[model samples]
Target chain A: MSRLKVLLPSARHLVTEELARGVVERYDEAAVGEHTVDFERRLDLGGFDDAVSAVMASHDAGDLSMDGAMAEAVHRQLRLSRREAADPGIWRYLAIVHRPEVVRHRWEYRSFATMRTRFWRHGTRFDANAFSRWWWVAELTVMAEDYSLTHRALGSSALSTHLFSRQLAWHHPTVAACVRILADAPGADVERTLRVLGKMLGLRVAEAMGREELEGLVRAARG
Target chain B: MDDFGTDGLTGGEDEDGTHFRALCKDTLFSNKREEGAGGSYGLGKSVLWIFSSFSTVLFRSTLLETQGLGNPRLIGRTELGSHALGPKRAFQGPGWFGEETKQRRGTRAESVWGPAAAEISGALGFQARNDHDTGTSICVVGFKDPTADADLGPVELARATRAALAEYFWPSMALPTRALTARTEAAGQEVEVRPHDADVAPFVTAWESYLRGEVPAKAPLTKPGDMTVVEVPITIPRTHGGEPEVKGRVALVVRLAAKSSEPRAGQVAFFRGPGMVVSYRDRSRLALGMRPFHAVLACGRGRWPRKPTESDLAVESFLRMSEPPAHDRWEPTPRLKAHYRRGYAKALTELSRRVDEALKELLIATHVMGERGPERLQRRFPIGKAGSPGKGRSAFGMSGLDARPQDGAWSFSGAIERKAGEGPWSVQVRLAEVDEAGRRTEEVAIEALSVTVDAEVVVEGSVASVTVPADVRVVPFRGTSAPCSFTGALELELAGRMVAG
Candidate 1:
């Protein structure tokens, strides 16, 4: 297997707003692909470009949902440690250099303002980036190398946004219990149930609560 | 490690090179350092020797100019504390390597140069410098820093060293003019340390915001990632100069961290010209429940929006002179009398005080009139007199009346409300149990009365006299009902009257 080396983020790696604009105004994968990045060392040793391409291809064919698949693809292919994943630079490099075609295809030829944050933005790493949010979702939801839970959570767009869009995602087990219960309870009105639970959980220490207790509270709120 | 040539060993020949003598001989004094340089007290070099278990260090420096016989110089020094050699003999306890010269009083040593320096450096396994490079490298022969860590091994020590370097100098490394790159090796494996490492990523974001000039000039922080820039003006009173005062401003860049997980979230990285962090002051109390934040107080050349002028340099020197031998904090020391006029300390105090005021403006939510919800809730209570029938037409009255009868006494509680206009309510409450003939049975002593508004509450014997602000419509009060001795039918035996004045 071939290992891929990545660059440490620097001014040279800056994907200027102009470059993102170019990607939008004139859709040129070749111009985006031709930009070279100087790699320092192998913090991310995964050779997963093929995996990313396969998902985008399948998504275009309507064979699979994009979000859950892309999330699983990133988590499975990158194998990023928690330390490496925290850096927005790595995700920026991946979105711009390694998989520009995929990012462009995923978000499509929209306004530069809309597409700019999908690639790079300062201080919005967790929420703004297309690849980072997916990987973090998988990382935060996965149970001991199990991506099954992540799929269940990301399977629903409203559930993911309602739960993980806020700081409540940091309380992993609380989020996990909510995802588990909401995923199982049919017609649970995920948004309405979660809105009520989000307020009640704020008053209590959700992190310290057990899975069963949180699930029970969530289940009760569904009623 | 060799990256030397342009600024190699200086033998203190030229005035610009006098820091060489100061580094070796003077313990706590600074040579005439360049403006915006760090190490004001020149004590950082001592850490090299102090970190070593044997109090010894080796050096190899490439020079741009030299007073010695040859170019790059090599030396070794050891500082064993002052101790005795024999019964009555004592040694000052500092030893040096190189050529010894007979001075006017005794003997002294100087660093070796050229072939001799190369020979010693090669024997100690020091790397060769490129012909174009210029810098100095020192090796703590028996390296150990108990305070940094309890006996860290090569890898752990290297990691700790890299972390400290990145943590303190992260702002410098993240800035557009970043000039430093640090690389470390342990057991033949090299790790390049960068500022955007996960541990310092938040700080890097904060410094990047400052460098990008993303700070807004006003209040009410819009989002978590928003930052506000405030100028902390520092005016130094000069002892003797062309100008009587040096006016300069340092930018205090305060940014709310994007997440609560940001390390050292509530600390303001305090530093001066060299951009080495002197302290991380905890100002978390300023905005108690606001989102965790990271701040940078850049003084001296690190000031933003402009380059450091000659006046800024003068203020930098004044602030540097105010620091103690440790250089950990800047303050008005007794030593300031030599360099600054009277009341020079006020600028330093203002610099510290300005940080709190600026942060509060950005993070602390200000009180807006009529915005508080509790005031609106107070208006919902119906206006009536406390301990009276619902028939008082006064401008201010009480409502939500509750007089719990237990053990032949009443535990009274109610909310005071405004009926008409703005003024004070001078009201009196009486507690007594009445008989069927409308006669007083027993007096219920007024133990305690608490009004939420600022008022003079005088509880004399069994009656309570109180005054409250008419604008504050809600004042929920409750007091203890003393154990009573009058035993009777507690149903229709309670009588109370609230007198309005």
Candidate 2:
């Protein structure tokens, strides 16, 4: 972990800029507190509002972890959809909010009240800024280019996935799942099963199996 | 919520009995002429109130086209009774609920402004500066707690705040490091940027392997699989320049320590290169543990396409060079030596030399330990005197001593003479081999024993005491000689102890 550093002042500044943009998009400020004072003098909305709106839209679009959808929404909103948006630096905020572990709580169908009660310790940050939330969601869920497999496996459990260390959440999902399956297999045979799997996987024969096939094997074995 | 009346509600007292007021700036504009710009909305102005109660907001603008005279300033106050979005509620109407003063900008210094700015600035640990030319300034006092939701201790709260900022506003973070006002002085400032393309998958795999103890002794050095090579010249130039030595081959060697569960696959080495490429590499793939090591070597050889053929003489020579000479020996425990062939010791001695050369290469590359570490090549085997295949021995013609082994145990007995003022001298009484195979041996338990007087043995009452030098090599014995000649028998119970002295 990099040594502890404070970013509160930076946070305050960034949040200020964002909130300023948000206020312009949500309300008409030319006539002061009254929104209807000069309805015709509507201002052009800034990228910040567009970002928030995009995040909200993405959240509305899919049952992909609400966080993932939120992140995509933010990416689209920020016009970073075609850029290096998945880069760790850009997506840290989204990961914090839409982590697989947190997403699991949403997916398991918990009540809004229970969810809200857990907000102080859970997804409360999602309400403040969807773009930031979505970025973080994607970061925590996808470890590599093969995010399709990670998406299938994690489904909505993105936030539920604990980091090996709070700082290190980057590992291939397939490798992680393979390890997990071996770890969870029944009885003292777990070692034997792991040995078999290791030998099989180590061989060139099973190298061609795609993620779906791998997941299928896991499911069949679990059954 | 019950109201705690204005008694403890206002901040602190000011110098002239007037509340300290701070100047606040709203980047949000109030005019339609400025509405088309990205930051024209006055919502930014409300954040000042969200921060402080007694504040003064300065509205400054530089318009491109002027239809106005006053550059109009709408400096106003949205006080403690103003409309606010609650912690868990949305903002719909104005009320005196007093949870927060969302955007209350006052005109000038009032009886409540100074203390309010101090309170808010202290909580946020920030300072405000005004740019008098064009931008705005929104000074605040009595600012509300931005982190009221936090339940963490001081340290944890700081950590949580840092984590959040690092995750969210990282790109535009003015202060890159997460620093609390109190700590910034002693620790200095810092910035933490997340890695761009970190592949943590390899680290995790390596870690798990370590926990399982499946980590090979050489495994800790595992790095991302990459093809690398160390080049060695194949040609020895001769006087006739017909073709100095155009051919060269790259070879790889691996050394693994012997283990208890399985005997180490004897220091295996594989040869490749000198026209070697893919299909040929397949031939060696059948050798377990050899393939990965080969793959690693081939990858190091830089863009080399195909595997080398077995018939390639230079390649064969390179491979042969990688193997240890046939006579190195690494000392083994007695049990290990028993498992090897009688002639294995000589062969191991040769192998030990080659292994030393290979380890030397690794040491150079890794700088694991400094140069001049212990060399296994210059080692020697241990030598010592052999103990008795004992028999009864005569000491001054005194006989009747027996030492024998039974059920893995044995015993010894003898006689000594006491004389005055002479030092103790030890005698050898052991069975000597009388046959070629050393099988026909008999003990000197009583025969060939004599009374060779060496020490002045002193008799003290029933037992005799002798002083032996500290460096003397003998099992401890009692009695120094007195002025009288005294004879006594010594008895010892030995349970299969080997006598190396």
Per-residue lDDT over B104-217 for candidate 2, one digit per residue giving the tens place of the 0 to 100 score: 552222222233433443344333322122222233445444547744454554454455433322222212232212222233543343311122222222222322434443
Comparing only chain B with the true structure, the TM-scores of all models are 0.66, 0.18
In terms of docking quality, model 2 is: incorrect
Model 1 chain B: weakest 10-residue lDDT segment is B492-501
Candidate 2: TM-score?
0.17
Of the candidates shown, which would achieve the greatest lDDT relative to the real structure?
A: 1
True contacts kept of 1: 0.00
Candidate 2 global CA lDDT score: 0.29
